[model samples]
Target: MVCCSLENNDVGWFSRRQSAYQCTTPITASQSCGGLLARIRPTILQIPPIHAPSFMALRRDTLVEAVEFPIHLESIERYFTMTDRRECAFCASEITEINDSKEHVIPNSIGGRKKVRGFICITCNSSFGQSWDAKLAEQLNWFSLAVGIEREQGSCPAKIVHTVDGTELRLRADGTMTRKEPFFQKTESDGKVNIRMLASTKREAQQRLKGIKKEHPGFDLEGELKNLERTAFKVNSALQHRLELGGSEAGRSVVKTAIAQCVRLGIAAHRCEIGIYTLKTPTDDRGFALFYIRDVVIDRPQTDLFHLVSIRGDSEKGTLLAYVEYFGAMRVMVNLSSKFEGDSFISVYAFNPQSREELNLSVNWDIPATELHAAFNGFGLDANNFYLACRNATAIAYHMQKMRERHHVHREELSAVLSQLGIPPGGIPEPKDRDQFNSLMEEKLGSLSEFIKKIPPMPDD
Candidate 1:
């Protein structure tokens, strides 16, 4: 039997020979040996294919192919060729027809060519246009290309190292040195002993050593650490500081102030009212003075009608009189008396003749003595005789009550009128409360009712 051995040229020949020659056989000079030699020679002589081409060759080939190759122009050249064409990049529909504008994949202003290979239709472009930028688009394309290259060939073991400035250093993929200053620098009075660390890479480590020699003019080589703790600490500290202070409360306070000032200036009136009074509850021995304000009203205009200014007196003596006024030439004076601690009573009569008589005429129904007392206690009604203080401590309260009742009935009617249309309800909390409910309201609706109201409806064509 004839025997032959073949080995890979790329791998060390010795290692392949050792692994291949486990069994030994005698070689004979004969016709069979010639046949075996012929078969083995062909197998050993054939050159292995080169998987990775040199950079220079690749660049040369790309340029030559790009120039020599005949590019098949797409059928929709009219849409893609013109940089300023107002047609949709995707569908080739006229921008005016679609009521939109053509968008560039790479924005023209940023050194990006006007004509882009990838063009999206107006609808698709508009959706992307809302939030995308050229930098992001470029980064996405670069990442995709990198992934493709990595998949074609397994990852290469190439590394770079460098000693950047005392603060930070980046070793690029190709042998290059990048130095970044420390965000914060700490120093001692005793001469500046600059501290720097080097990344472990062949290209950068050699370059960094040379740089250190150049910088120091003549410095001895220092031992390297397996872990760069000082450099890592500095970097981590810088990152922490950036994360903490960047766009933090200090940064957002200015925005908050601007919004608050804008709301205060833009809104027509101060939609708020304050009431101060003394209450004599049965549980308490003496009446205590209290201060309270009505809930904030966003839309309603403030009216001074039957608004109480102040209350002063003892609850037991019934000497408490509330000084109050109404919007139009109306004033009231009320005397409150409590027979029992729990049960208080008040007699509401106009201070003047015309007002009292008008109020008496207006209130035809027999007023409950306790209710009148509670009304005076809760809201100063006798401040103006003609106007008996009505529901809640709001002038709009009467209108609001009527509106609320009508709201239920008008809900269906208004709903029918507003079907498919987004008219927000009239009631929304004032701007002061908006911050509290911003997340809730923003989740349910695109914006708060108050904010939506500020934006005028689109004009009918």
Candidate 2:
């Protein structure tokens, strides 16, 4: 009689002896070992047949291979070692040193500085970065440029916009605009041709004049170039900006961030069934992601532009959810999974998009899993809540815009103050004059604070 003591909860593995095989009663299938067996079926099939007492005998008549107990245990141990290797949460590819890459829980492109390891392989990271993440970043670049969002990798991206008057503008990161192409308007007044040239740079203006030189051989291109005056042009008219928020590509990107947040919280990507499914399939307007439904208040300062992500798991209700707000402008909720079997947890991350400064944030959503499902399907009063949230977000964004304008004005005022202190505008004082400069700055800098009080109220206010 070979006595094999293989009693365990998840998997049963027999101990090895040098001389003979000792076999005890096999672990019962009622202890969840059956599920373990199913998972390791491929490994089990690779074992060579040995004429001995069955180690996994569910019945007394079931006689199977267990001739070499030590060899069998080694094989099971090797299989488990391979199975325990880290894999990408999205693609399930093994994460080796060659393939391991830091994944930002929020995308670095959109001012997301938080990063985690062992959650994704480099290949999947690159693929998502090019597809969904790229699109989402492009969609939010306008707001990023406006708010001067701090990024871990690079500066905010510039975007091309077409004004209502058919002027193509390249919006810069510092809230400045330039024409996409060198443009000149020709107007005739009182028998004289007045050419108005608007070029992005002096080089461009010179190039434009060179082209005009070909039109008239006698024209003094060099002379007119020397007389070129530089002036600032501001668009006073209303410029329409249309921001289309959600679709397949952008939706997948949002879900990716949500999944990364879950992975950061020690939840495996495979457990996020809905999130993975959404990433795999093509999504439409009614996808797994939706505009945030539950009532939420923007308690942060109105002038602060923030990017926020919140993840929560309800073990009793078997629901896992993620909430994301981009630049306090667009908000989305992702139903990560409905079969979550983890302990209840809530995690939040918030940061000023401009400063990349982390904020201590608390987020709570008492809404049930059923309501979340219904919210995704556009049921009940979710539409009302969504509208209200959007309105509030817009109000905050508008306030931020006004504040940004005031900030620019304050810079000019500071320059004037510097000139009054016998220092050239934008010039640093000499080392010898530093003592006097410091005293003057302290005396006059308080006036700069007055600009904040003059900022206009929000549009809704």
Candidate 3:
């Protein structure tokens, strides 16, 4: 049997028996009670406090992910070099003040390893970090909670508001959840679960009822008491759905992060806004807002995390396209150029589920750019003709074959969509001539304006 004692001799910092105790540090012992014959005064016993260095030895009681407190960049010194390029990558404004602040090509809060020197000035960096970057972290943090993905945050507990029994309760804890003044506690002995309420006393409960009655004046105290008594021993309960009280910040950050990579790669500042994936199906399409990129970029991290910034281009595909896709996770590919404003050159490219690599510049696979310009009210281009004007027919046929298989989409559906596209169905006809496909596709696209003109003309009412 193990036993211990808090003897009076070990009560003070200056006590003779203090050395007998394993605890150190100054402790002010409470005043001692006199002898039994003397006044009845209590002596306070001081327990040894566990210092910070010993925290690791304690066992955790709960399992949860670690998340950092939102990162705050204060008066951090501006550092990092800039390219000879004089324009800010984001706003496309002139970067006159070059030496004031440094920019992290990837955000630093969520463990961004790489840094970019300049091209994005300090003011812009700080602004984006506070607004856009903060938004990204919150989205990530919520994702962490929703999926139970553990995050790392030193030794402090992360504050998360989660739903409990359809009610929102804020949980603050590390891997070991801790709560103060819990109204009830639970214990499992046999196969069943149990909840033990900690009501102080019958009188105390009555006082609470009386207080409620006094506050509301019209409350039915007796009826409430009867209901409480009826449910006093009830134990079964079920958890319904959870309603997250958060804002949407996933898709935009993917674009922002990708843009940062473009800025780093020496893409002209104004050209950063080359294309934007349609925001119509933002969340389902873009990412778990791309938290997994962190996993791909870093060593084993706390979750499927972060986004990648891949910016590349070739001359054959005349129009730029930007879109994001999701399967097990989400990734984005975009044309990191702003050629839309100067000349009309645009195309819409779908993210291929099989195409894991970032830059797949298929000259034959593209959509008309004027479509998006019309959709986004112009800030776009038209690239279908530019690419068709330089397409390789065999390669086009091969690319279409791959797309058809990868999507498990029927060839009929493909033909139907292409028919609407006004491109010749002959372009994708039965496998015969190696060189005839491009001509057929061109023949179809050539009569596009005439076909548009010959259509029913909206039928004069």
Candidate 4:
């Protein structure tokens, strides 16, 4: 028989047995326990307790994808090492330590969150903190691009008509004239006047009246009537020509088609004026198409002014389209408001959704800088001065760095450099009085450096 006992010390309890088979050595509790266990049937061996398997692996897989903050060990490590305690991503000022908080590479308001990765910095995060739902960067980019394209194209062609009682005149070819008369009537009144007037052209009638005027200085009645007829004829002719050129069916059709395309692309149309008898229809996406018809005949004279029309359209689908209705009749003119006169061409910007930002991607057709400067003058800002200052800043920075290595410092030389940059003699601020300017330059450089650091290392490929 085997006995089993529990013990608290190093020496185990021993069984009280002395025989040829019994050993005299102290039997450890383990040994006693083993003997007892051995006495049990071999088929019924004792077994150790079992524990439940860990679910940590499954939990990690389930949570990593959905959690916005650092969820996995690798990400957490990266957060601490790369972004946690960085400076403001945009402004580049050190504020917190790395690992203090997760910086959003993209701001949350613009559909960016911690899960998206590598878009936000601490300062930018705070600046845009909780201010989500601002216009998406993509939309801004699109708008900027659209505005630029339109500005470059100048104003779209429009058909305008102005009509006066018993007369209609149209201005065409920038300035041309055509005359059409429905009827001509001469009535004789038996007053104290006994004079017959007949001439081949209106100019001949005027010449005849001028001779009569010299003989009878006070005989202004015939001259006044002749002047009236000439004026009416000229006005009528001008109006007819304009209508023939601008208010034609073909012109209307071209405009209609262009407008339809703009509408489909989600662009807005402003001040669109088609010729009379033009056909127009709405676009599926939300715009209009116009068709010019020249079938209508107008005996009366009229004049028209096709003013600027503002167009808005969808950029993603390329909605806006422009074509010459009458190639010769259409002329694009950019109005120079006093402020923007010198700016011959304005910059257009487009919003990029992928970059989540706006970029000035293109310029209107090349315009002279002088024109743009004149344009800006209307705005009460000294554009020339501003331009010179900007140019000087760049020149100064470049030359200062170039001369630094040579250890040459000359105010006169610097002033000459400023002049080359278009700055007047006294435009540049003195170095001793330029603390703010220096700080601004340093801040800009710092931001650029920080931005470079945030860029991911290039891949081998």
Candidate 5:
């Protein structure tokens, strides 16, 4: 266990047991939390008093991920007295301010918000993003969109889905779909030209018309615009989506995330020798990632759709293992290193991908080191557990779909109320009539209690 308390010095200092470690030196107050935290040792550093939430959390929980806390400091001694943590984990090059960058344990595109700095240099970080993280994001973006996950960076990539009748559609991040291509038909009979064009949107139709006008120079653009009609069709056909996981690219990414979590848990990245080697050398072998369902079960809180990561180190067994799960459907166990000779440690992080909110939870699996290795090597695989996980994922998706439908219905009802009040679709009432508008809206929309009862409360934090 680690414990730290603040000192009354000009610069904040923390003492761990018998030893004292200077976590921060006097620096400019204007520096951001990320920039300030990056200058410290990569090891676990207690958050300052100012960040009460994180500081209090740290006192009660030892396994929580480190939170950023800004402190006033000048450019004094930045290196930790224990070890120089500025060395890159992959390349072992000295990390300078110019080369340092924050690396997310989970890819940001897939709704990961936690990040660590000074663990890997910018070069290795960029390379991993382009290769490992990119492939993983591509493989998981469909589920991300379906879950309506909140991303730390750009929005999740849209997926190309197909209907049962073989119609191609672009599935957007918000659970909406549009035709991949515009539909156009032209007919000329009895010296009269007839043209029919249909598209998912008016803009799409107009763009297609531009191309058509080139072929038919005598076409009337104004008449066509006046005749344009907006159509909404309900698609009853089921959607078909394909997901393939555990490729070399995605395998590397899983391993990378495991190693990153280990680093965040106070294990130096250099100590993760096997993980570094596996990431650096690319191969077609998918054994690095194995579907894992805990043989020893413990009841965990129900989380609809969450991303989970856990790392365990057993010095006696001389093994370090990590587990990564995306959307609670695909679970993977990775053997990080077999030469681990550090103290036994375990850390878990579980959060709802949709809200990007961390959950107060823990995960436990009682598989022995030998059995885990055997499983990783393709021995004694459990097909039943994998199937169960997939089924559960499908159920969660269906639940989310139903919730979205309810919200859509609510929006339509609200729109109807606005129309009744002589308000435009997106316009609000004037300031003078605001009170009346509120009263009318409440009277028409019914009680808020009914809506709350219809939508279940989220899982406990």
Candidate 6:
């Protein structure tokens, strides 16, 4: 994580501050670790003035050695923020504000917000319900179930897959899950014991109920067994039916998933400057189920609700990009159509039925776009992991283009800068070359002449 400012006291000292730091000494502790700290303890502050102070004296050696530093400051003037009604991040259509409009960043089906602090015009919002958001939810169906998140009742219905015997079937929340067990008794038979299982479902029980008369006309068994086994089966069926998880026939409501995403990326920004990135959900078997859904019977079980949503943004990164991380596990990124303006962390709206709390964190956007970046101190998000894991020339081409266009530079110029960076072209570097690649990319981004201060976006409201 890097906090950039050209306001050092020793301004116009070295070619770039990065070079000055490279020339300084090493230390065990970081300058930015503990917040509310006004200064690095002086004991460890001997490294250099290049760090620590917003202003400092240039080392005589640095002033005498490196080439002349640029005379410009990297301060941004505008800050991008989200608004009530704005353009769609997906369709590029204008979204008008209305009384009923609500955008869920994670989507209502996945236990996301119903009224996130931003908006995704109703049109594009609806389209996403029919398309992108739905597919995203589909991709994460298992995790959602494991997390015990619920879907909005009506328009955004849950797609539940239940396995019976060897077959997999899709189900909506309106009906019940039925399983039958057949119980029959035989009085002292020919030195043998018999066991039978009854109806696995209501329909099957009703269908199988007709056979008691034909099969046992001569047997006389009163007590609870007096009735045809079918009658007893019906009673068991009523008690055994498993009602769906998220109640049935929920009211029709607009989902706010994409809008929540927009808020996370600072939708207050202008549309065109934001960048969007989508990553494939990881498929692996690890950890145990977050919550278990079972039959609601005697000693009733409490459904543990784990519906949490967080919208983290980096407004200082110039381009507003969203990073969706599910706890410390799953992650996704959506670049809004705008630029972020200042240092901001994640704005979390956690819906825990057991507790109520509020949280705010601050993060720097100038940090390296590493695959292991975490939004907050313990967010456990690697925003670029999956994106880089499956990196191809085309996956990042659009954002690269946006970066190029934003700088008003040609590809060759960018390549030349990248080359001088000592970082190889493209972003992938083999494991053995990881450290080298990181150093090079840092150099490339740090020393570019055309790389001016990042500009934040302005709100449309």
TM-score for each predicted model, relative to the true structure: 0.16, 0.63, 0.34, 0.15, 0.67, 0.37
Among the numbered candidates, top lDDT falls to 5
Please report how far candidate 5 places residue 172 from its true position, in Å: 0.9
Positional deviation of residue 155's Cα in model 2 after best superposition, in angstroms: 3.2
In terms of lDDT, model 2 sits at: 0.56
Q: Candidate 3: where are CA atoms >4 Å away?
A: 1-84, 90-101, 144-159, 167-173, 176-250, 275-306, 320-335, 338-461
Query: For residues 1-461, what per-residue lDDT tens digits would candidate 6 score against the true structure?
Result: 11111100000111110112221221122221111111222122222222322101334344333423121111212344543355555554565556224665555555554455334456645644445455545443433432334465643343433222222222222221122223344454686433243443334434443454356564333321322121110111001011111100010011134235445555542342322221111221010111111111122112222333333444454433333333222333333333445555554443432122232322233333321122111122221221121111111221222233334323433444445444477644568766765675455445333222211121111
Better of 1 and 3 by lDDT: 3
Model 2 bad stretches (over 4 Å): 1-84, 185-196, 201-236, 283-287, 297-301, 368-370, 380-388, 398-455, 458-461
Alpha-carbon local distance difference test for all models:
0.24, 0.56, 0.31, 0.25, 0.56, 0.31
Task: Return the top candidate by TM-score.
Answer: 5
Instruction: Give lDDT tens digits, candidate 4, residues 181-261.
Output: 222233447754434553423454566667667866778755364232211121211111011112223223334333322
- Give per-residue CA lDDT, model 3, range 25-80, as digits (tens): 21121211111011111122222332222112322221111212121111011111
* Candidate 6 global CA lDDT score: 0.31
Give every collision pair in model 2. 2-23, 3-22, 3-23, 3-24, 4-22, 4-23, 4-24
Model 3 RMSD in Å is 33.1
* lDDT of candidate 2 over 344-458, digit per residue (tens): 7677888886677898866766654344444364432233333334434544553454466446545644554466556777788889777877775564344334434433355
Candidate 5 residue lDDT tens string, 242-296:
5555667777888878877776766677666667777777763432655543522
Error of 3 at 313 (Å): 1.9
Shift in Å, residue 135, candidate 2: 1.5
